[model samples]
Target chain A: MTMRSLTGTGMTEDGMDELLAQFLVEAPELAQQLAEALLALERMPGPGQALDAAFRHAHTLKGSVQLFDLPPLAGLLHAAEDLLGALRAGDRAPDAAALDALMAAAGAVEGWIMGLARDGAGIGLPAEAAALGARHEAALRALLDGPAVPAAAEPAAALAWLPALLAEAADPLAEARSGSQPVTALHYRPAADCFFLGDDPFGLLRRLPGLIALRVTPRAAWDLESFDPFACNLDFAALSTAAPEALRQHMRFVADQVEWAGVAAAEPPASPTVAATRDPGQRLLRVEAARIDGMMDMVAELVVAKTGLAGLAREAGGPATPLGRSLAARGAEIDRLVAGLHRAVLGLRLVPLAQAFRRLPRLARELSAQLGKPVALQIEGEEVEADKSVVDALAEPLLHLLRNALDHGVEPPEARRAAGKSEAGRITLSARRQGDQIQVTLEDDGAGLDTAKLRRVAGERGLLPPAELDALDEAAAMALIFRAGFSTAAAVTGISGRGVGMDAVRAAIEALGGRVSVASRPGQGTSFRLTLPRATVITRVVLLRLGEARFGVPIEAVAETLRLPEAAITRLAEGEAFVLRGRALPLLRLSDLLGLPAAPAGTERRILVTAGPAPCGIAVDGFAERLDVMLRPMGGLLAGLPGALGTALLGDGVVLVVLDLDELAGGAAAPLPEAALS
Target chain B: MSIALEDGRLRLAGDCGVEEAETFLSMLQQHPGLAVDLAEVAALHTALLQVLLAFRPPLAAAPGEPGLARLLLPLLGR
Candidate 1:
């Protein structure tokens, strides 16, 4: 039946679309979990929790897809659930063909979900899905009829090798044969260029949980003088008593390179016992990020209103009076409660970096294959938590960076070998929490930054004048890579030498109120470090007043607050400057910088020192109390304005325009006020 | 379906459906070196065939039915 006939019954088109979107986001994850569980069941067929999990995944998919009334898709999952139920009840054990059918059904459902996501809910299941459903139904019928004849046992050649290999490792194989657990014999012959694709045969072999025996042999005799270390010429055969699921999972990434079978001699365990452990309690709730962001905005508004209320209560009477004292006491209590509430809400927004890191290994593997460079990716500190917004925004930039590392940073195997390094290059992607910020660093051990080449390219591109380029130090010259249209590659390749440079990476991170930096040494390696805030819901700001309008500067950016007398300020040819601890700190007037009305300057003006590599002092008419305020990035026309970070509501109900100190300091080139020196 | 041990031969005849798979498998497992005679077999279910393939015993006589030979002989790589 057509999808429209099923889906358009009770729900509106918009409702269908919303549910489709949710299904698209959620169904694939469930389908993947189900696929893994089914593989586990195929390896160790028994009445157990694995079967239950597989059943639940299929059942959940059926229920969700049924919501949209996709008949074929839902029917496929239903058939799968029945097969699983039969397996769980000890009605039948799924042989190889049965497992294949189950996998095919799960895959068809996933494909339908993708189609729905791409074409909206109006899209119907393709004919292939119907065919797959029919196949699944047939398989289930056969299974229910009773255990079909198992496939022809292992091929004769494999059978012959099995005994010889077993004879070679008699003791362990004997022990393994005594157990009820099934034993899998695997023969893995990786691609000739598997090394280039970042396949670690040894590492994968070592991780087999119940390794019984392992043999590694050169596929052919090596010629001493003509040997190519870069090429993978090895064959690996292993016997592991590991659960079939574990073996399959370990080989999943390189499935094409391996052949595996369960030895017929290793029968199902005698008791066929189920695992005693129950499924772990699921503590996580899958909520849309936008909802959490909306809640955060509301909490910000409530905190502002609460602060306003406390201000009014304090103004109602002095602390000496009974009413004033009581209001003051209540206000303090509310302050504590609001702070606790704010923290609890902010905690909801934090997610682990692993969400983004998990997708990198595959990317590295694929890119390494494309570039013909073998790269070992080591990921560390994936458990570090950051704002969900930050994690979501990080994915694309991290992809670009990893692509760059694989393409440009990692040298070819021959080049690496010639340089006295291993033929396979290494890339390390690590994240760590330092104070309130998360530092994600990607380091590569290959050819480092060629500063001389970068400087030459920068000069040729006219990004900076020759004199300025000459004056730049090594670090500053290296920083030129972030300039737009900057590329140091001699020839453009499809992978990274596209016109888009590190400039885009920096721009994206900076847009998130974070900064990106690079450190590299010639002949060593390069590391890119991104420092981002742990959460974006609320920020501590130092409030300053210019004219009647108040503005908030992020407290992290404030170096020191001081009363700078007019006598101490000096006039420079460029603009106003002040000597703070023997360093010339550029001074900017906040009112002049933001193009706001200037309040009449009073003697001994308050100057807020902005901290960074280049510290700058901003003169304001007065200083207000510090606060933890919700900072929202400006929207609409104000979004284009320079030096405005976002807007925040204050205790007194005034909207504080938070300033972006980096932009303010960089753009302060207006003519100095001659009247200020008077 | 009938399975009998006669004259050191495991003889099978008639329809061997999935219900007879367990009995067929146990007989094959108990007598590791027994010869199989499928001369009078009518229909052989896949489950029973799977058990025969797993045991890999020597066949004493080819199936009387050409269709059974076509279905079962190549699987034994004869």
Candidate 2:
């Protein structure tokens, strides 16, 4: 249940090294856990559990630092232990003051650990680290000397006798109520080089608040003669009834790297304790990711089979037949069961969005600082969940947009103040879900896109005619920013305004089955909202026919499908245009966009119109059917076609090309012959 | 947070603002051994002051003799 498993185990060199490496890796994670726990504790101050976590964290940090004579690390850790010790005593509560100091000290210790890990360097504490320690040490001296803090003294005594008493508790209710209860299990793995960082994992765990159990095992076992004392290869796990939160806070300095999770009452794990094992380093289970993947693959097959059965049952004559009725009923039941299982299987791939959110602040800060503008990035909705694939593809474009906002949307601090804004411009990055889509919006408070400047830049980039730039509406003009090689910056800097352009950002999002739109006011800040499909499994498309070929058009791009009379068609200098209620709409035949043979249009052909800065109509030979289907991207040479999103294999086994309206709407820069296009 | 020096320690009490923490941390530079009194401290914000404390002074910049430097280096040095 705790470190007791390794009690009699002889330590080995290799085991010790592995244990130390694990600790080095876990320290930062523990620190992060502490931060989160402390934040939670502030919200729910009555939780005794937070105090316990703080104690454990400090206990671990202190213990690990002791093995090596890393004097500086030990001193700070010792101070943190004392402070957390006071809080656990219940005589002194963890107020914001103590928490801040504790967190700061933890961070310092983390830096020290990191420094040592990088090289065999000594932790050089900042003046404040020493000052803070002095402060905590003074407080600790006061508390240790004062009347016995009940919780602190109780743990000391209870831990001393907990092991013998917990084994003797016969009844569950009695066990729960007993002061000797083991409420938690702690796992500690100190890196082989832990001693170099002045960390002693064993000593730290030994000082835990309610040490009902303790054990030390090497990361890997080796002959005792070859056991390297300098190599911190031991890992320790302990069980105690002390609150988890307090233990977390006590070890917040290296919070980013440790992993901590609660142990269920039923999963004590029968591993030999530190004092019990002959060779404490041996591990019993090592589950490979590939094996889990194999299990998931089998589950997926079961789902597909269940779907087939349901389909077969629907085709059966009637439920009146006894066999048919039973089969149908079972089929329906299996459908529901498989659906639930499918969700659970898919859930395994969902990860918290916080993984990406953490990297944003520093990025925002750096861009803002580089631009001589003060921009604060406000991130929210971090708990939103998305598949790992989506999260992985999101990082870069988000960074690009952040850079774009700083480079173009925000003004210098002085400029901001002159415009009646705060010196620090605000850039907010937020994610929200609507239906089955996730929208990530980046908004800034600087002067919105300089339309005139954009127009000038567009003209310079040859994206627009200088003479007609003034005639273009704001939305249409703003869209120019997405054009390739577009840059409004007076001069290119290391950050942005390069040829990569917003087109790159648009391309990135589109690659993930998403679309990006910009909304802004001339003097107000601009907002870029990228709406992405939650997953790539299924796409919603409006199916239409061009002669004998059926094509799919994404629902997002289709504003409406109108059955227009031939009279609506009007000829323009550039090409054939259509007018519906006096608005001039450019028309691009679906056949022409797909490079398919143009079919003779019927008197009443359906025109699918798109919505954006520019609306375009695509005339199909006939209207087929609209269905949402799974679209597999076309590979090889066909992937380069901008107009084609992908292709789907329909139930009839016919391959239908999916149209990318956004790309088609980009208009003809180097148009092929009108006849050849179709 | 209310911070002042008492008995050679930087005595801190009351709720500490992140912005003000920076100023308080700067004060510690002149008085490195300043001890803080959190007994009456109501709140502490993990801002510039905390970050400053957490920021280990580079060993290359550590003062020659062992005093506060000695106390702090081991906690932060590699």
Model 1 earns a TM-score of 0.56
Supply the DockQ value of model 2.
0.01
lDDT (10s digit) by residue, model 1, range A536-641: 6577888887777778899989999989888888878777887788666778888778877777766777888888777788889888877878876565667556
The recovered share of true contacts, given per candidate in order, is 0.00, 0.00
Worst 10 residues of 2 chain A by lDDT: A267-276
Largest lDDT belongs to which candidate? 1
Q: Residue A409 in candidate 2 has what lDDT?
A: 81
TM-scores for the candidates: 0.56, 0.45
lDDT (C-alpha) at residue A384 in model 1 = 70
Fnat of candidate 1 is 0.00
Error of 1 at A384 (Å): 3.0
